[model samples]
Target: MSIYGYESLTGRTAVVTGAASGMGEATARRLAAHGVRVALLARRAERLDALAGKIAADGGQALAVTADVTDAASVRAAAERVRDAYGPADLVVNSAGVMLPNPVDAGRTDEWARMIDTNLGGALHVIDAFRADLLAAAAEGRPADLVNVSSIGAHVVFPNYAVYGATKAALTQLSASLRTEFGPRGVRVSNVEPGLTDTELGSHIDNAELSQALDGMFQAFGQALTADDIADLIAYTTSRPRHVNLRQLVVLPTVQA
Candidate 1:
């Protein structure tokens, strides 16, 4: 995507979870390029620091924060750091998620729990941490936004994605509910559901059968969407006029039917 005419997005502070790589990393770079102050949050301190350094070198303001969104305490601490460096973040993106596929017969309860903890619980933790700031921004008549990164798995019932998809489904519903409650307050809540994006997200799969199936299915779709594509979509959603809210966006590859 070309440089965005982000007149409305410039000079805003944004906190992005999972900013170490993939969608989070892409989103951070895109926002920083558009002259927004971006805070990178993830468990990988070294990776976050590297990305932050790159952004700074490119003349963009950024903060690298080592945080685990699954843990409320960690998220809260990260929020404190962001507030100190960039003030309360008016823009927040929940992109920290795990999609470990485990079939019902596999009985991988651990993976299921992991998905719930990170995919759903993690989003909640971040939202709970920064929700007050969002509300405050809206109260101040400032533009505020919360973007949740979901997956097409939420809409389609894939064989092994049952557990992983469930968490994403919950996230989509949460975003919808938040928009309904917060829209009147001027806080735009949006859910971005991307289909078959090319990212490291596939590396977490533990199910061999499921992995092969997904691989073949994706191969059928000539070209998979890239992280930059989704990042652009997210930036566009957040850059819209405060009065305009793209509450739910389902972005899919043309061949992803």
Candidate 2:
């Protein structure tokens, strides 16, 4: 009766960042359906609460907690709350991110800093905070997974997305490096990269021309990939056999290539 093909996760706890919407929201919903206790994290308290309420209404366990991933102190506080409520997450998903397209010639340094801080810094903060919990789960012989949501843009660079791509590239390397260090200890680390998914990510682009260009690009595929598509992949990756590790997966719309 499990949609994910794995029911061993029934009693596990998962902490998902960016759960207010997009891929993170879909992932949380998917996990809840599989009976995993989910902790939703994002800066939007109301949205988080709404999601938690919906999950509860569906007969799934969920807790909504608000935190800004860009702030280490905020992340730590959210970690403490989850630790107290769930005891330690068996799965952690770093789906919090931002995409702001601006040419280097524009001198929009603030956008670059925001991308680096949220995309890369946020991932590190979440991992560092919940690392001990992952270790504890492994020590108890439970399969644990750390999923970092990246972007195919990391490898395929467009005109003005250099800095954003670099952050994602760094994330991919970070996941790979962590897998080497953590895989031996029974923890799974994975980097998930998706191309041109339809999300609020592109709306942050302050460049009017680039925003229109991005809109045209997103429409080129007829319709871009949905958050649910990526969520399905996330579910499948985490549900793989314990010995099997999906170190990295790049998912793009068929028309992308």
Candidate 3:
């Protein structure tokens, strides 16, 4: 533990999904800076490799493992590689997600399905793959954390964002349930809800109108949160003592509300 009473995160192992870009990438970098061995997981191998290389050059331990979170087999294989590289993960961050919002009357079934599968199903896959490792870490009295990156859309209503909101809401509820099941078992479960952040999450939107509206919203906020901002909170949450659990966090830009 540090002099400030915060548990030292040095020498711990962490797994961060969606680590190729945005918040996942930033969180991976932050954790590595704290001396944690990080495993970068995402569908983009090149991005993961570059990030891993950057971490290595900075004198931190990192392993790049390409994975598709929607596929159980892929996540399982990636978990095996993580175990081989850095042993069981003491921290896991489920940050892989998609936000393709469109009006419910627009009948954009494809977008809705993608959001549900990637945002909700994908998180479950990572949890299923790493549950045993987390339990093991807790059994040894290490500070183990499972952080789920949901969005403020889970609690707030937005036009043309019904499906996206549904998936996030489900994720939030799931985190709450898991907290009850895992809290006493020693692993800390945290649900993080971030509001309007400047990330590539909006670049893939198929609906032009909604995309423009999102851009306008960000512009109006003037100072929007960045990936690094959320990373800081995540690092703080995971660095607490074994007995301390920061259950839920809602982070937003000062200008956002």
lDDT per prediction?
0.91, 0.91, 0.93
Query: Which is the leading candidate under TM-score?
Result: 3
After TM-score superposition, what is the CA distance of residue 134 in candidate 3 from its true location, in Å?
0.3
Clashes per model (N, Cα, C within 3 A): 0, 0, 0
Q: Which residue pairs overlap in candidate 1's backbone?
A: none
Residue 171 lDDT (model 3): 99
lDDT of 1 by residue, 1-257 (tens): 22345778889999999999999999999999989999999999999999999999999999999999889999999999999998999999999998898777889989988999999999999999999999999999888999999998887998777888999999999999888788888999999999999888888886677778778877888798999998999889998878788888999998877
Candidate 3 — which residues are off by over 4 angstroms?
Answer: 3-7
Between candidates 1 and 3, name the one with more favorable TM-score: 3
RMSD of each: 2.1, 1.5, 1.1
Q: What's the best-to-worst order under lDDT? A: 3, 1, 2
Cα-based lDDT at residue 94, candidate 2? 98
Candidate 1 TM-score, true structure as reference: 0.97
lDDT of 3 by residue, 1-257 (tens): 57353247889999999999999999999999989999999999999999999999999989999999999999999999999988999899999999988888989888988898899999999999999999999999888999999999999999888999999999999999999899999999999999999999999897788888999998899989999999989998888877988898999888777
lDDT (Cα, tens digit) per residue for candidate 2, span 84-119: 998889899999999988888988889989999999
